[model samples]
Target: MGGSFGANLRRIRDESGLSLAQLAAKINYSKSYLSKIENDLKPPTADIAKRCDSLFGTAGFLSAMVTAGERPDGDQDEDVADDEVWVMVAGDDGERRFHRLPRREVLTGVGAAAGFALTGGARAVVDEPTLAGLRTMFGQYRLLGTTSSPATVLAPVIAHVDTLRALAAAGHPESVRRQLLLLASRAAEYAGWMSQEAGDERAALWWTHRSVAFAEAGGDEHFASYALIRRAEIAMYRQDPLTTIELATLAQADRAAGARILGLAARCEAQGHALVGDRAAYRRALDRAAALLAEADPAVPVLGSSSVSDEVALADGWSLYDLGRPAEAAAALDRQFPGITASARRARARFGARRVLAHAGNGEIDHACELAPAVLADAAQVDSATVRVDLRELARVLARWPGHPAARELRFALGTALRVRPGSGG
Candidate 1:
């Protein structure tokens, strides 16, 4: 994989008529380092690949090459060994520590059942009131997630899932057990999203798989399809459009899936199409998603993002940018972005960053710069990794006009938001 990436990089660089030194200068890498990468003596990083892709106008080819090569071993499955356990401890300073450790170490002298107990007393009854309270708490947690850093929300969400699982295993009524498991699955799913926001893709996949396991244990087979959508989202972030499309298509294959799930899957499929520059397919998928969403029952439990009122519209605007219709993208995003609630800091940051990118891509440098400060503020508040993807691209776009004062200022502000050195291909 490394050899393939290196060869491709060299081929593209040569085809573009750039010397090693010239390419290195453009991408902020040392000439010697670029040479080593071209020779396959050193592996490429995702950052370097993105820089080269932006420089060479290869869409996401270089980034996809890096993603394909860098995927971790054992990332395709959601299996946990029986001999392993997740141990969490709460401290007096309101900090929680979590670790996955060998079961033998923690259960040395204690029986496995006793070791897994939440407390040293008779089991607490899993009742309606408790379940209702937990459900309400989960809703609150979801709201908190939108505004707080994922790091701030992840520990409690995981702890809640563990509690729900423990309650479900306490020989409760079948109905109660199923509800508990389903709720646990939901929390676990949210944990997966937060994990992604925290920039740990492997952990995000693990939690998503765990969500599917929980849902399956509760006899809710529909969640497995939704889990595919989640995986598709991760693939989208990796710039692997083919995998994104495949996973999203599989997600939509379950005819029995709810309208909301199908709609979300279609939205993801549209993103996949946009990534590959398939404008017609992207429009079809987006239209399908929008119709499904409109026909969906609002009383049904929400699956994906709850903040965005019109996800398909926002996605259409987002896809337009990827389809090289930046002026149209800017207009569409401008229409939809304001509908997002101010409290949805993460969502606002993500879409707002894209809107700024669209403006920049349309050569509205002053307008892009004018819009950036607020988006950067929201991005910093949320500490979002996804938002930084666009910000990095914005930095690249603004770099083309280093002499323009507003562009230079915006670039420096972007560097600050991303916590990288200015003009360093953030």
Candidate 2:
């Protein structure tokens, strides 16, 4: 139905040699707004259709919507359906992400979390079997963390990295030079993630720095760049736009880094620009990210793998949503979230919150609230400052909505999450 209406509008508008902005001018709306409507976002109302029809000398451009509205609300179905997800994650704002997962992801991620819990003192050796084990843990952890909120999920993440440090120090095992460094790299990332979820920016920074050092030492420039990305994330949260842009740019210059680096760098720059309200800068960064996305090669991604690829698209979508481009942001997220494996759950949970933000920006209150359950569940799973800060932001946004049945329930969850009452069953 959307295809038919969109085609009609596009055909009439384009054949008349009118750009989107030109048509928008005739209708007294913004070019982007009109484009969104044509793209099936804001279904044209009666008045809007009359104006468009009069201008195009055509009718029925909005017939699809008139017909569709007779049925049930589509936005209601757009709500995330992952019920029974754990709610242990903490958030600073409210962005939640849901990553795809393979069946083996949970076992691997849970094991790694357990291992790190037991061994926070040192590094680990990496034979094929050992690396494979950690890899599986990472894979599953990634998936759960992405889809579920961080509150329920962050404890295991903290434990996993701590244990990785201990595992790395196992009797100076053979071929251990790079292996130990890699272990540090992996541990650092997990530590950073946990700290970020727990609402401790200072801790998050510490872990990010440690992650960067290890990745560098291991000659994994790409992973090291990831640490740089997290550092920039801290800066963005602190409202230090200039600093974030600088750090993101520095990270971007590391050509040895993979596609993820380019995407993250662009995403950071976009976020900084958005914070400073620099529309031009934000658009340029977003465009650059979109262009760089084509360079992403298809790799054989399996379940329970912890390898870093591109997080740019998700980050970019977030930046766009933050920058008043909610409709485009939704398109970007829709494309980005489906491909990632479930092993990346923490990040995925954050992405889900982003989706909620997009819905809110688009005036879909019910859709946004309906998604609240999954996001809140992930919030319980997340325990990093990075994730927790996002939760805080989410709570603030939810607060603005004024009235809802779950308002009080969500408020309690947010309050409990924001405060660090250790041993209080947080």
Candidate 3:
């Protein structure tokens, strides 16, 4: 695959009439590095493949070639050791740092009794009140996550998961232990989402697997199904539509899974179908998702985005764009987007960027430009990698009208938001 990728890259570059130096300058790689890649001296990184694909309009062929030869991420079933714990220390400058240390080392350093007590001893009992408080705190953290960067919110969420897991491991009543572990699973799941937002898919998968482990320990059988939906999302971002559909379908195969989980899976399947321009399949999956969502139990905690009043509708709008119905996509998004809560900055930014792309694709350059600044502001605030996907597409669509003042200005802002160099094609 590496050699094939190099051959394809060289062929594409030659056909585009670009010298090694010229291609290197365009993609921000060194001439020597490009030379090595062309000679199969080094495997092409995913980042370089994307840049080259964007420049050459290969439609992700280069990226596909690179990822096809990669190894699996690793085992997802391994559990964190009971003897290992995360320790946090406060510095003189008020900065906090966390470290993972063995229980024996901590006991030796802090005294056995103190260390045992700090890490939740066997005598520790978590009651309903404590669980309720933790749940409330988790809700607050989720709300905070909406308005902040993932990097800012991730550490505290991970720490909270560790604390909950520690408590669950202590000798407590069965009901209380189950609830504690369930909460830990939910926290771990959120941490996985934050990891993805932070652009670390490997960490994202690890956290998601941990979430499944915690949930199973708590006797919850449904979360593993939910984890499949999460994996499908990662595949969706990677543009692997078939894998996304496969995972989402497998998630739905668990009949015991809640309506919320099934609905989310169905929604993911719709996205996969849309990605491949299968309008009929996309609509069918979307309709199924909408019906399931309407029938979902509100008493249960929300499994996905909570800020959007109608998640299926928002997804439908985005799918329209994917299906190449850009005019209708823009209208659908315009109608649905304002209904999303203002505090859900990340969601707004993500859908807003898609709306911009839809409008740009429909040749409404001015309206697309008009819609871009607010989206860019939200995108900059949230610092989301997922939202940047659509923002990059919006930049490309706007690039068609290079001389239009609004288009050029929006392109510059998009470039800044994406942190791409000038003339890099984003």
Candidate 4:
């Protein structure tokens, strides 16, 4: 149904020779809003369908499409079946396969269970194998977060979280129930992180809150503290250093937070200090974090298999960059980045963008320009607002040398990187 509606709408809109913005203006909507509908990221409402019908003189044809699309079997073209939503479902042999189905079908089937889960209804039994499968699926989704854009993975992550919550409420042994809750918390935390990267602050906050709740319910104080630290990270990205510092401090105050979480909180605090140009405080915070990180117990697991020392190093590099010590920043980042795998798309993109900024800061305009394209290429793979912000700032610096050939080329690249082209809306 999504495929059919999107295809039909795009065809009609193109044939009518109206750009997305033009039609949106006629219909009293934003181009980005309409683009989401046309791209299947959002379902068309009856009002939108009616408006489209009137504009194209289709005599309610578009409205009918909307109505049909609400049904399970509506306009499902087999030729484009491959375009349907697919989710990873683990098999008995430790393999996973894509389970393709119409969106409506999956939603309808899962909604009741989700509601039951929320209401604490009578437990429904699920076997051990099924539980393992669900855990495997969560692991797969978490792995994807490193490589895929948030927009590409957000829906599936949400769906998986919903399913996990439902399973949590179902009949299970106490131990299994606790395990399920832990997975749900982790899922919510990942979703929150993704939302932050995608620039959805409210959603990120909401998901992070949910994560903390679940983690606490599961008696995982470490994860709860981690969620607060994640929230601090979000504040930092938004350039709210005060809020970042406050949240980081709050997380550190949690007695249950271990050495690794303490290190994370300290790192967050250090970033805040760096942002405000408190060199002494920043250095003290970095040293404190490094000390705690070195003493973190090996038994305690941090999210994403991240090493405390590695994280502190990256944060220290960022602090150096923010404090306007570009050469030192470059040296620090150069030492750290090679240890980061190419598969870690978000990390690599972020560090690479900062590296470009470091070069530009040191008056190495040509070198910066030489590196910008590759950095942007990798950064484009993740829907990370933080990376975009860094690139934009670098562009502003490059703007000072407008006539320089390298600067000009970089500006052209920035225009392409930053602008929202037709059909590629937020």
lDDT, candidates in the order shown? 0.81, 0.59, 0.80, 0.72
Cα distance off (Å), candidate 3, residue 21:
34
Candidate 4 lDDT at 135 equals 76
Off by over 4 Å in 1: 1-79, 82-99, 102-119, 420-426
Query: TM-score of each candidate?
Result: 0.77, 0.56, 0.75, 0.70
Per-residue lDDT over 195-242 for candidate 4, one digit per residue giving the tens place of the 0 to 100 score: 777766666766777777777777786776787788778777766556
Tens digits of lDDT, candidate 3, 1-426? 335778989999999999999987665456997899988888886556756765676655676676674534543334446676444444565543444568566544442244357766546556777778899989998999899887678767876787777677667788888998898999989988987887767667778888998999999999999999999998888777778899999999998898999999999999987765566677899999999989999999898788889899999998877665677889999999999888999899989989988888777899888888888888887878898888887787677677899999888887777884212244
- Segments of candidate 2 deviating more than 4 angstroms: 1-127, 137-175, 220-224, 296-313, 327-348, 383-423
Best by the TM-score measure? 1
lDDT (10s digit) by residue, model 1, range 291-340: 88898899988999999988988999998777656778899999999999
Tell me which of candidates 3 and 4 scores higher on lDDT: 3
Q: Candidate 4: misplaced stretches above 4 Å?
A: 1-129, 304-309, 421-426
**Model 4 accuracy (lDDT, Cα):** 0.72
Show how many residue pairs clash in every candidate, following the order shown: 0, 109, 0, 1
With a 3 Å backbone cut-off (N, CA, C), the pairs that clash in candidate 1 are none
- All candidates: CA RMSD (Å): 7.3, 14.9, 8.5, 18.5
